[model samples]
Target: MKIGIIGATGNAGSAIYKVAQQRGLDVTAIVRNAAKAREVLGADANVIEKNAFALTAGDLTKFDYVVNAFATPTAYQHIDLAAKLVRELRENKTTKIIFIIGASSLLKPDGTKLLDSLLQDENAANWIATPIEQAKELTFLKLIDNVEWLAVSPQANFVPGPAAEYQLGVDHLLFNAAGHSIVSTGTMAEALVDQIENPTVPVRTRFTVGDK
Candidate 1:
């Protein structure tokens, strides 16, 4: 499969990039810095450096799936980037899109939210995370009626780990018997690949990753 990963140099993205190659899937690392991504993600795949939001239909002819792990350092840029990508994806119909969304949009037990969980504290790690953009992206993506897309929302706590045997859920929280929220990056990547191969989140649908 020809997969294009945006922001393919970050932690989650880099992990996906590595696994894609290990699976022998043809992949492209889309980012601004070819040198840095080649250093972090290493070489052996196609490197497409440029913005996807502004990419014309002619430039969108290479890949079959686009996983957007890209995020701007600032809040405004984050929203803009996501919004533009959604618009472009709606316009450009050449590739299937699998967005690497944040878990901030996940709801908590008390009916609050994971995104606002750290809203009170300015120093919380999730605060600076990219959920805000994910929320906006979700809103924009929901409006498009005829697009093949998958928005995979991770568990509450996602860290580097091997793909533990787990269950997959749709549009809801996935919790363990102990009620701890978690999802391995490896398993999440696996699920993302599945959606890419067989889309279930296309056009106003969602999928979740966590233990059941």
Candidate 2:
């Protein structure tokens, strides 16, 4: 199947891109810089050098599945980009989208959103906007019914590492055996491609992945 990954040079995107490559899938890196994508994903990497916001419906609908791993320093763009993509793919029948969102929208053991606890942290002001907007992105997506979409959220302590065993949860936050809410980029990639190849999570629903 053909797959296109936006922001394929970033940590999560790069990891997923590499996994897709190893699986011998027809995967292309939708990146801003062909040079940077080459540096991160080697010279032979399939690339479409363009700004994510500049992508057109024709560009996206060519793939069977498009994974939005887009990240930016301007937090609100998360929601904006999600809207843009949905608009472009409205009523589309050929391509589906998988959004990689933050874990802030997941529920804690106490039944409150993890975003609530994050808002209480003193340092939250600096980086909290990203999660907040991502939560809004999910919220906005839930209101749409005409598109084929699925969102995947990583654990609270998402980090860079090789692949490991993982567990999946819906809505609720999950902790591994050592009691850490963590998921490696490799593990997340595995989960993503697995879903792409054999999707079980229904369209329009969101799921979380945690290291096991």
TM-score of each: 0.84, 0.99
* Minimal lDDT window, size 10, model 2: 72-81
Q: Total clashing residue pairs per candidate? A: 0, 0
lDDT of each: 0.73, 0.94
Query: Highest lDDT among the candidates is held by which one?
Result: 2
Q: For residues 46-153, what per-residue lDDT tens digits would candidate 1 score against the true structure?
A: 798886566654455477887877756765565676566656666555676776667777777777777776566767665655666676666666676656666778
Model 2, span 1-212: residue lDDT tens: 99999999999999999999999999999998999999999999999999999999999999999999989659999988999999999999789999998999999999999999999999998889998999998999999898999999999988999999989999999999999999999999999999999988989999999998
Best candidate (score: TM-score): 2
Angstrom error of the Cα, residue 145, model 2: value is 0.7
Alpha-carbon lDDT of model 1: 0.73
